[model samples]
Target chain A: MNLRIKLIPYERLKREDAKKLVKDLKEGTIILVDAKLDPKEEADLIEETMKVVSTKFSGIELSSMELSELKETTNFERFKNMVIERIMGKKRGLTIIGPAKIIRKIEKNPEELLLYM
Target chain B: MVVKHFRRLKNRLASAIRKVFKKKKEIKIGLYGPVNSGKTTLANRICVDWLGEELGKVTSIPHETREIQMKEKVTIKDNGRSLTFNLVDTPGIATKIDFEDFLKFGMKRKEAKERAKEATRGVIESIKWLDKMDMVLVVLDSTRSPINQVNITILGNLDARNIPLLIVSNKVDLKSSSTSRVRTAFPGYDVIGISAKTGAMVNELYKMVLKKI
Candidate 1:
């Protein structure tokens, strides 16, 4: 019953950012990441995060979404332009990371993604 | 690499081990887990499959099974061989059994208290009967977190006694279910997810059971 979520713009993700993420994950926080923020470096950061928490139980589930789909729902997110710019900038979806000990499972639905946001 | 090598060695030696346990015509397979995790449901599935009868009643209420239930001489048909077993369905184990918890479900306080005491005794008996188990199925709800201490303690005790075991992650029929989480939690153990109520992936479980023992 412990449902937790966090939204992070992966485009701005840094090595230090990854370190903090490792800490939050240990606390059982499910982090949602956007790859557009730092497209070139998110994967490496995730890899780094994996290595940091590798000895512990963990998992990741990713789901993709179109920026247009998100925009249609909220009538225009104040951050829609940023998301669109980022999607155009090559960020395509959301990546969820959490302690597998708690996160357990995930279901993908882009439309429902806003609720978590 | 070490785990891989150990598994290879274990597989190489499984037949020899099987020969020893196989001599006892009725291998005792214990069904154990926390309350409402579906141990009885799986037990019923196995019993019905081999004996044409359900093992016991299954309900949504916790600790409904306050005593050990048994079904004997269930012969399982594997690849080309038949294996018989005495399926032992035990009461759920809990660190704390509070009558108040049962009272929340609308049971009278007096009955709830009595049930709690019986459940606590059942837990003790289940632990004592561990020695009777030739092998055990640690059934768990796949939709829930696998970090509970009850199962961990049971697993540790089983490890100490060198009892062979397989984790049955039940209720994979739920949308929120994920065997992968159980897999990650017990990286070294074989964990299988199945919906015992619907009999999904049960054949896979049967094959794994044959391989495990």
Candidate 2:
């Protein structure tokens, strides 16, 4: 099986609906988002994934890591990052979404994410 | 700005009035978390502590509790202060439920498929029931990393809905369990470490629950 990984900007992701993401996932393509999705967006994605679960398409394995959450920073730096995230409408990080059938699990650590197939 | 302030005040006043007149019997405290996070164990502990019975069956398999189970009129007394409310044990939430995963646990192929299908529906029902909870206990396995999408999403949805919540870092009896890790993952929430299986520090959890409600 040919493995396909699609890199999607967070802006484009926000512009497009989660259905599009789920569609890519259904086709067995791994998706990499430029920014970590907020909790609501993640929840929305899970809901969308659940709607499309079938025998072939089980669901999605999603994991995200925020840059700000990785390292300890001063209060000022934290505030600055927050301001930037608010202005940009997404956190500075990386998110990986893949079909659960393909990727068995996404092990997450404080600093990194490991995808196991 | 004045209108905004007035609206805030009005909302506060209305909320206060509602709290004053609200019936205690209607209060629903929900147990929510990812799959295999020991939510059922916690529920059973709470039930046996207050109601002299267990709420549901617990197992090593994921998605064991595929439906919402509720026990009413559970009253907990702490320091001479008693509180009573309905306890709701919800099915564990997961982003995926592949039938093949269950086959590894010695389940038959047909039974695995059925369990997977029911598990998917259970996830949907759990999410749908979130809005009905007066308060939620987000149970997390302390032995596992707490930064997963399910944990983040659960915490986020609760925050979005303005629902009061407490993070229950369960399985403290395990050597790998670390409540500090859970705290580090989620810094601003109320976190309590407990061993639901062993009934360790559960009284502290009860006190925290009473304080939250």
Interface RMSD of each: 17.8, 1.4
Summarize candidate 2's per-residue lDDT along A1-117 as a digit string, tens digits.
999999999999998998888999999999999998877788778878887787799999999888776667666777798899999888999999999889989888777899999
Q: In angstroms, how far off is A76's CA in candidate 1?
A: 54
Q: Write the per-residue lDDT of candidate 1 for residues A1-117, one digit (tens) a residue.
A: 676788876555443455677677767687777642232233333344434332243323223343533525453552575567656564455555556566444443435432222
User: What is model 1's DockQ versus the real complex?
Assistant: 0.02
- Which pairs clash (backbone N, Cα, C closer than 3 Å) in model 1? A11-A37, A11-A38
lDDT of 2 by residue, B7-89 (tens): 44543454455468776548889999999999999999999988899999999999999999999988999998887888999
lDDT of each: 0.69, 0.87
Which segments of model 2 are wrong by more than 4 Å? B1-25
Kindly provide the TM-score of model 1 when superposed on the true structure, using C-alpha atoms: 0.62
Structural similarity to truth (TM-score) of each candidate: 0.62, 0.87
lDDT, candidate 1, B1-213, per-residue tens? 344356545644653675676685558889988788999999989888888999899888898998999988888887796667889999986544556678788999788877766776677667778877878899999998885445655665665456778899999999999999988766667789999999999888888888767
lDDT score for residue B177 of model 1: 96
